[model samples]
Target chain A: MIELIQHLINGFSMGSIYALIALGYTMVFGILQLINFAHGDVYMVGAFTGFYAIHFFKLAEHPSWLSLALTLVVAMIGSGCLGWCIERLAYRPLRKSPRINVLITAVGVSLFLEFAGQLFFGADPKFFPQVLSFEGDWSFNELKINPLQVLIFVVSIFLMLALDWMIYRTRLGRAMRATSFNLEYASLMGIPTDQVISLTFVLGSTLAGAAGVLVGLTYPKIDPLMGVLPGLKAFVAAVLGGIGNVRGAVLGALILGLSEEFLVGYGAPTFRDALAFGLLIMILLFKPTGLLGLKRAEKV
Target chain B: MTPSTKIKLNYQSSILWGIALTLVWISQSAWIGLMNPYYLSIIIYAGINIILAVSLNLVNGFTGQFSMGHAGFMSVGGYFSAYITTHYFAQSLDSLSQIQQALIFLGSLLAGGCAAALVGYCVGLPSLRLKGDYLAIVTLGFGEIIRVVVLNLDSVGGARGLPNIPGLCSFGWVYTWVLICTFVIWRIIRSSYGREFLAVREDEIAAEAMGVNTTQVKVKAFVIGAFFAGVAGGLFAHTLRYLNPQTFDFNRSVEIIIMVVLGGMGSITGSILAAIFLTTLRELLRPLQEWTQIDFRMVIYSLLLILMMLLRPQGLMGTREITSFFRNRRGDPR
Candidate 1:
């Protein structure tokens, strides 16, 4: 029972990272109906940014929670700027083009960013210098739980609540909802729709950046292509939960993370990829609109 | 008409085919002579890739079904062909006289093509139901699943890759398979079935309303496309006389997709031309050796795909044939 609990906790930590990334994918897809394939690369850049801030800037080592807080705000904002710039420059002009063209461009942007990172940082995996290391283990019956897992859980819950509040309560959130509901209608209503789109990207990417840094701290290794698989899995999660739906994204991420764990437990570790992709296929065939996403049928 | 006229037409037709074949043959042998068999081997593999890319383009470009599983069919063909050639005539091939060896080699090639064709039909049966991005993801998953399953199965020497399977191919065999696949694909493109596939690309509902059985048409193209991909795999396996699971990754499938996309997707000659160009370009670019200190292929591919999408959007040749130049100058078909 304890081992099961421990595994569940581990899965939850991984799932939260996926959930954070899925939110970015779902949110952009919600408003624009574009699958931003580069969203994963955005997550990657966040981790790299945070890594450099600590490693190159010589931030204090394992600082108290307060000092660590400053680093996150800076990292999140940096990531937000990057996402905002990408959307404006690479994506905005192609908005009127065919979906396939946009999709191909998204893939191109993803490669460009990843290769850029590789060129700048070199191809070798590097450690994300740790700060606020908590070395403690908790045992309940027989399950060994780490302090890091608890931190992951608490931080994710707080962020999720904050995001929920933002989406449901804030003025920008209302603008976002109205835009997604009907872009032209919202534009007529005098909403600064373009700004909202850019802000939506910033908000989503900020969360992703935080998630990337936290996950990097836990995993302790970072590489350029690291985001590709995780990004793909998260996209599946968004679809599974229903893209354009926030809570659905979270629920889908948890399910995917657990299923991945289960596959690791029983199947060849290599087969986890097949398992996740297989689920994407099965879910699409059964529920094309996704579990949480409300279907908006196109006019013939 | 006199018998001489009939003989002249046959002679002209055979001459055209012969000239084409000899050109490819002489060029390949020239490659073999200029560099060791190592470079020759690379060129042969590149031709095999052209076969895979051109076939895949029919399903992806003409039909508008995004399938990233080219490597799956290739592996299926690879393993099957290897099993037949090695399992059946290993000792006979090893101990036989020259003429017997030659006959067995011919049998193996036919066996490989047939096996690949059979699997194509089986796989294509399911493709009838899938469309768009949904089809792509499924195909991608199918490719990965095949790789894992092959790695696990020990009979075909799974993870280690089958090596020492008898290098039985020459320049003749390689070019011959390429010729057969190219001809078959080109014929399909000019047939009534080609119209149906194009219709599916234009609009599925319109095609359905127009009494075209969209599902059956799609399956036919998918099956034939998979068959050639398989044949390419067979040729590849024979050329290398080796097989490994790693050789057919999602990346390899993506690479072929790139070739088709880089070449005008619907233009058969364009895909063939692009395949040869990109394959050679990639090899040639690998020699930068820290001078420019860049992997130029990725940047070239990224820029080309992005630029084509942003500007041309429909690749260089689009659906127009290369011969359309002369044909257009002469007159319209009507």
Candidate 2:
């Protein structure tokens, strides 16, 4: 029972970060209707940024909330800038081409970033310096929850709530929502569509960066290739939740995470990927749109 | 598009030319005048790739389905051929006259094509519903699944691939199968059925509205493509005298797609050209790897792809055959 609970917590911890990244994928798809394959690589960039930021800030020495806050700001901003540049350079031109061409371009950009990252940064995994993580005592049926895991959960929930507030209440968020709802309507209503798209990328990348930082703090073993699986999982999460729906993606991520852990417990570890793909195929075959996805009815 | 602009390959002369070429292939490669093993392998590789790219061109170029899982189907062919050779055909070949060996070779090629065709049908069923990126994603998933399954199977060398695929295939065998493949594909493409496949690419809704069965056309293209991928896989297994799971992974699929796309989506000759060029280019990159000490061929490859997209989005020859680039240019306005 304790192991099950522990696995559940671990699953939630990983699931929370996946939700953050998946939200970004869902949002971009909502507005553009294009799958940004590079989104996962941006997550990697964010994690690396955080690694550099934490290393430079010496939060290991300062050991305070202020240092932590400062490190996060720098990392998130760096990731946001990286995301912005990638969008401007690679994707902007392909907007006029066929969607498949754009997809191929996305793949090319992804490969370019991954190889470039591999080239500049060597293949060895790096240890992220610990900041606020602390081991906690077992409570409630002997399930121990580390402070880092708890912190991740808390931070993720807080960020999600803040995002909700921004999207539902703020002017920029309103413009974003309007653009996603109907780009033509938003543009005619005086919302800057290009700016909205850029902002969406920025905001999505920033949240993903935040998730990266938290994930690094929890796992700490960072590498250039770390984003590939997580990125793939997040894309799956986005699909499971229904491509354009944010909350659905979050729910999808959590479900995938939990289910994967359960699979690990009861099934062959090698079958983990097979199970995930099976679910994907079945979901796509039956639902097509996803759990929370709505099909847009075309008008003649 | 217009009847007046019909392709001008002289069929009667080409038939005579084909016979002359076959006589040259057989005589130049015969045992009393023995075919060199080195040349045999290259000839076999070319034949296999011709089968693969021509078939893949149907789905990717003609039908406009961006499937990157051609290697998955290829691996399926490999696995099936391995099973048949080891369990069924290997024992029966003890009486091994040249004619008996030839019959077994024929059986394996057909078996490989059948295996690939079946898998292709299953994969194509998804395409009837999904469009564009979704289909690509599914194909990628399918490729990964094939790799993982091959890795886990203990009988077929588990993570290591099944080795010693009973090397009965040879220069004559490969060319014969290649002839069959080429003739079948050529006839299929020129027939009215090929017109339906092209119609799906020109406009799906219009094609569907015109009483054309889009589903059947898609299924047909997919089946043919799978058959070639299978034949290629079989040729690869027999030629290399080994088979491994890694040989038909995601990257392998991407390599095949790059050939079809780089050559010209629907152009059979373009795919053939691409297959040869890519095969040689990769071999050439090996020397560069040792010399440059910067062994990131993928980096160079990625850059090449980006440049291709930027410069020639329609690929090297587009939908036109390589022959068109030269022969059709005569008496042109330019």
Candidate 3:
């Protein structure tokens, strides 16, 4: 029973990271209906940015909450700018083209980021600096929890709540919602669809950047190719939660994270990677609309 | 214009095939001996890639199904055929005559293709019910699942990869399969069945409304495409004399998809040309990569893909054949 609880805590922390990334995927997909394949690489870039920020600010030496907050802010801003640029440069021109063309271009952009990242950052893995040492653990009887896990959970939940508030309470969020509902109608109704779409990318990328830093703090190993599997899995999570649905993405990610933790804890470790895809196929087969997705009839 | 003219065209086509076969025979028997091994190997690899790209085009280009799992099918064919040759024929290869050895290799290729086609049937039957990006994701998932499963199988060398397979593949073998794949797909594209594929691509609901059995047509395309991909994988395994699970990953699938897209999705000749061009380009970049100490080839390739989509989404041939240019100039109706 303790072990199960321990696994649940581990899964929750991991799932929170997935939720951060999935929110970005779900939001971009919501507004543009294009899978921003480069979003994963953007997360990678964010991690790298955080790494550089840590070094530049001497956060490893200082180790303060202020430095950590500064690193997160820098990473988020850097990734947000990249997301905006990706939208403007790679995707905007292809807006009038076929969805397949956009998809292919997105893939092209993804590959470009990965390979170029290798060229720029070098192919070797970099050890992320520990900005804050969450050395001790909180123990309750046989159950133990790492302070880092609690920090990750708190930060992610806070970000998600902020996002929810932004989307539901703000005028920009209203514009975003309107744009996603109908681009042409939204434009006609005086919403700046292009800006709204770009902002969605920015917002999503910012969260992914935060996730990247949190992951760096937790794992300490950062590499260019690290984003590929997590990106794909988070995309699956978004799909499972019902893509384009924000709450669904979070729910889906948490489910995926918990299941993966249980699978790794109790089942064969080699099949961990396959479990995400298997769950995807199963969910898609049984509930194409996803867990919280609405069923819409196809119009000819 | 007349029955006699149609007959004359058929005669000309047959003559062209005969000339091509004669050239292939000559190249296989003698010309290969004269060529440098470096260039010879590149040519062989190009031929194998041509087979992959053309077969993939049948489904992605003509049928308009965005399958991103071609590499999974290739890996299945490769591992299965490699298993047959290594376990069954490795011990007796020296005892067998030339004819017997060739026959065994041919049999393995067929077996590999059949295996892939069967797997394709299973994957396609259920997945084909979905459309567009949903279908793409499902296929990608299946492909990843196949790779993961294969990685865990100890008999196939698992993650270490299956090694020491016979190098039975040659230029002649690869080009022959390439020719067969292209010819078969071309015939399908020109037939009434081809129209159904195009109909499904143009609009699935409209095709279904017209009683076009869209699902069946899709499954057929998927199976046929998988068969050719399998054959290509067999050829790949034999040529390399080794099979690694990593060789048939998502990147490899993307490479083949790039060929089909750049070649002009539905254009067979374009696929052939693009395959050769991309393969040769990669080989050509080796020296540059050595000098620069950076892998710029993939970077260039990805950039090219992006630019191509932006500039000419229709691709090089844009669903038209190279021969169509000549036919159109002569005012011959296709």
Candidate closest to the true structure, highest TM-score? 3
User: Per-residue lDDT tens digits of candidate 3, residues B170-283?
Assistant: 888887787778778877786666899889888888999999998898888889999989999999999999888889988899899999999998899999999999999998
Pick the winner on TM-score between candidates 2 and 3.
3
Q: Write the per-residue lDDT of candidate 2 for residues A1-300, one digit (tens) a residue.
A: 889888899889888998988888888888888778778878887888888887776776766667667766777898899878867777777767888777777777667767777777666788988766344544665667776877788888888888878887799888888888888998999999988888898888898888888888888887777776687778888888888887788899999888888888877878777666666777889998888887861100
Model 2 segments beyond 4 Å from truth? A54-71, A133-141, A297-300, B1-17, B20-24, B27-50, B87-95, B169-182, B291-294, B325-334
Per-residue lDDT of candidate 1, residues A1-300 (tens digit): 555676688788888889988889888888887778788888888888888888655665656676456557777888899999988987888888866667767777777777777778777898877777566677666677887767776787788889888888888788888888888999999999889889888988898888878877788899987888888889889889987888899999999988888667656776777777778877876786778767662100
Relative to the true interface, what fraction of contacts does candidate 2 keep?
Answer: 0.46
Worst 10 residues of 2 chain A by lDDT: A291-300
DockQ, ranked from best to worst: 3, 2, 1
Clashing pairs in 1: A62-A132
Model 1 lDDT at residue A57: 55
Query: Please, what are the lDDT tens digits per residue for candidate 3 over residues A105-178?
Result: 98899889888988998888999998886657889887899878878999999999999988988998888888
Candidate 3: regions farther than 4 A off: A296-300, B1-15
Candidate 1 C-alpha lDDT tens digits along B219-260: 777788887887777778877888999999866887787777
Q: What is the interface RMSD of each candidate, in Å?
A: 2.3, 1.3, 1.1
Model 2 vs. true fold: TM? 0.90
In the predicted model 2, the residue pairs found to clash are B30-B33
- On the 0 to 100 scale, the lDDT of residue A140 in model 3 is 89
lDDT scores for all predictions?
Answer: 0.78, 0.77, 0.88
